[model samples]
Target: MRRRRTYRLTGGLAAAGLVLLGIPPAAAQEQGGLETQLRFSQRLTQEDGTLSTTTGLGVTLSSRTRTEAFLFSVDSGLEQDFDGSALQQKDPRLILSYSRESLSSALAADFSYRQSDVDALSEDDDISDGVLRLDEGLLKRYSGNLSLQLGRDAPFGGTVDLGYSAKTYSETSDPDLLDEESVNATVALRFDLDPRISAGLRSSFSQTDRDDPGQDTDSASIGGTLDFGVTKTLSTNAYLGYSRVTKSTPGFPEDVQKGLAYTLSFTELRPNGDLSGSLGSDIDEAGRRTTARLDRSLELPSGALRAGVGLSTSEDDDLRPLLSFSYDRGLKRGTFGVKLDQAFSTDSDGEEALNSDFRVTYRQELTPLSSLQAGVVLRDTDFVDDANTDSRKLQLDLVYRHALAEDWNLVGGYSHSISDKSDEDRDHSSKVFIGLEKATRWRF
Candidate 1:
């Protein structure tokens, strides 16, 4: 089963490439190929000052047949534990693709089981999911393209009420995170109205079934996009979407909710004129909402300078506004990028929910045979009245990637992160990890 799973994972990727590259599935019989990858990771963890070690493995395989292509992959890992027990996670995925001139389709199945000795909390969870997509050309107008798809999704985004319930309504509260199995159907349409204008619309509906965890939900969403060109080099795009969800189970908390999102972006670069910016926002029915996000980018000789601002307010009587900036530069060797963001609130309760994060990414070529990358991340989050009211985290990562042979490659990397909370000294935690990957492919 493991070997088959690995092969399937690789076959799936190869098949996807063939389809996108306009190669017919029948080519597998004419010219077959193989793909695979193996990876391993070592980890160390410390919580409340105590430390432990862990290791993980991942395998995937992919290939194609005359009429179909398949992929399968599996991952396993263990974590640190305080009571002489740790965590085990096993995830396996399989995908199949079939394609023809007029019709192309994909089926994906994912199964995951995780056991953790949150020994302190006594909680265990197991979950699995399957998804399918079928795409067919409906119409090709001189102005647009249209397509439709149908599939299944296990647990998507969860509601706060649900999160709170799952936390067993702890004094501070955490909701239900379980979203029952849902079937989905959608249609997307894109139009090139003119050389200077374009538009698109997408809508989907979902029906859920009851499961062991919590209430089921039915939902639907519709969104549209419009773009216009002011000049040969200046253009703008606007987008809007609305969605709603309703609980299916009878006694479920009135899990009725609606949300709306919007975004707009503009760019101009007609010599001497260097301007680009975007605005986005979301509003939800529960009053737990977000207002807007604003971003601007400037052309610079060194690289690109970008700035952004945002607003988010929860109906729970909390309000927050945020701002940030970023810069990216490309060198002969690689690229370097950095950004920082902070959220400021109006009230004390809101203040506790404020958060900030800073990060830097740098990549450079170490030699003709290898490349290296290093990054650091720091973040602070206010948890309000939760048992742990605040969290500060810092992490560092380094990676060396290289090609081993004509059809082989290797990658080594390490990452470590730490989180600290005030008052609850026991809530502090840290994790260190290292990993290596190698892969080879053969063609026939």
Candidate 2:
């Protein structure tokens, strides 16, 4: 799977082209809407006894048709220190996204180019999903996904899913965080043996490529699935499969791992919610891994709740616990929510790491034309193989908005961030900002 680096923009372009072609010119000329927004802001930040001010501008344009949508946005800013230093660019971001959907298929494509001084990853961004570096710099990313269903109205049907993602860093010295590409595809064919029973065959393949040979890896699997309706509200599924994983390194021999894979799962539909549980084992470059999990969702008259718990073990014989819980409620004039989750994932180096995340959010209407929102998030990570790399991060945000007139609003916010690393000293920063935003929309 290891190969020399080559930048490929064909896949991204094709995805966009397909979406454009899928939209009929007649439809595009018919019903459509566009929205444009502009923002001007000034911020004051204090960090470690140093003060700075930043001025920023942002613009956004979006359009949507019956079956197609497009978005583009850009944000730029310049900062100056109180010590008479010249203004310097802080961080800038440009983003574009396109999506198209039909009765039997859906397509989504996104591209982002951003510069930052901190880690390029976000709270929801997975290091395992793309090529990412531990350090921060200019980053460009592209991703596209497509899903199709064959014979939508027929009893015998199948599904096909394809996804691709790539990442590249600009002017980076780190070999691990350079150019990277990933692709995955899955296909399934099903036949309805009867009204209560169905069987299917599935195959999947995924690969991640990077400049570093040690990080290049691929996995493939083929499986058979059986679905049975035990009752009107209960169903069960069983999958039996074989999987293989391969990895390459500079000095070590190519590692080819193979193993049997299987999963048994059940789902029960309740009056107000649902319950699901699954047990499975899969092979990876590291070795064979097994997991068991149960999840439940509950719907209340004014709120909702979801929870899950699981346990997993790998070839190393190390056991790890997984958990997730979330609750959200609507108030007369506000909303409140809390969430907590812990799960196992791999870093860019292909080493498994456990991550724990907790968040709380609240929003309230303070006046007829004003609102307030607040949120707090905490994240912790522990490397299974390297304890010295464990780290914790915290973020606090508060924002207030008041309508000034039609399509105009006054916005202010405060943000605080802190990071604690086992191998580095603690770091923290705080910022306060106020901005004016104007938005307009047109329909045709």
Best by lDDT: 2
Local distance difference test, per candidate? 0.46, 0.68
Q: What TM-score goes with each of the models? A: 0.51, 0.80
Q: Write the per-residue lDDT of candidate 1 for residues 303-384, one digit (tens) a residue.
A: 9887877666665645566778888898998888887766533111112245566768788888888887777766566543
Q: How far is candidate 1 from the true structure (C-alpha RMSD, Å)?
A: 13.0
Evaluated at residue 8, the lDDT of candidate 2 is 9
- Top candidate (TM-score): 2
After TM-score superposition, the amount by which residue 408's alpha carbon in candidate 2 deviates from its true location, in angstroms, is 2.7
For candidate 2, lDDT tens digit of each residue in 153-235? 56688888888887666655555555678899999999888899999999999998877643678999999999999999999
Candidate 2 Cα misplacement greater than 4 A, ranges: 1-124, 127-138, 170-178
The root-mean-square deviation over C-alpha atoms between each candidate and the true structure, in angstroms, is 13.0, 8.1
